[model samples]
Target: MRTIMVKVKPNASEAKIISENGNELVVAVAAPAENNKNPLMRVFEL
Candidate 1:
């Protein structure tokens, strides 16, 4: 799994993590409050 240090800050609504497709930041999914520590891991689908 991989992690992305989003420029957006945490605890700021899930909408903060936008997707960059075609250089355009689009709304992806609504992730719940993830109270995780450093070195996060992300599992992508497709």
Candidate 2:
């Protein structure tokens, strides 16, 4: 298994992944930070 870091940006325009470089993975989510409603489902959908 390859371990990587996920960077989530809440309340953005749309849910999307910025990039994956080195040991870091940058992503943008449409859901807000409240109630843990972040759009994490699309993270591993890549």
| lDDT leader | 2
lDDT of each: 0.42, 0.54
lDDT of 1 by residue, 1-46 (tens): 2333334233545545565554344333333346533333344433
Model 1, TM vs. native: 0.26
Worst 10 residues of 1 by lDDT: 1-10
lDDT tens digits by residue: candidate 2, 1-46: 3334344456567866677776556665555678455445333333
TM-score on alpha carbons, each prediction: 0.26, 0.36
Candidate 1, backbone clash total: 1
Q: Give the residue spans of candidate 1 off by over 4 A.
A: 1-9, 22-34, 39-41
Query: Which residue pairs collide in model 2, if any?
Result: none
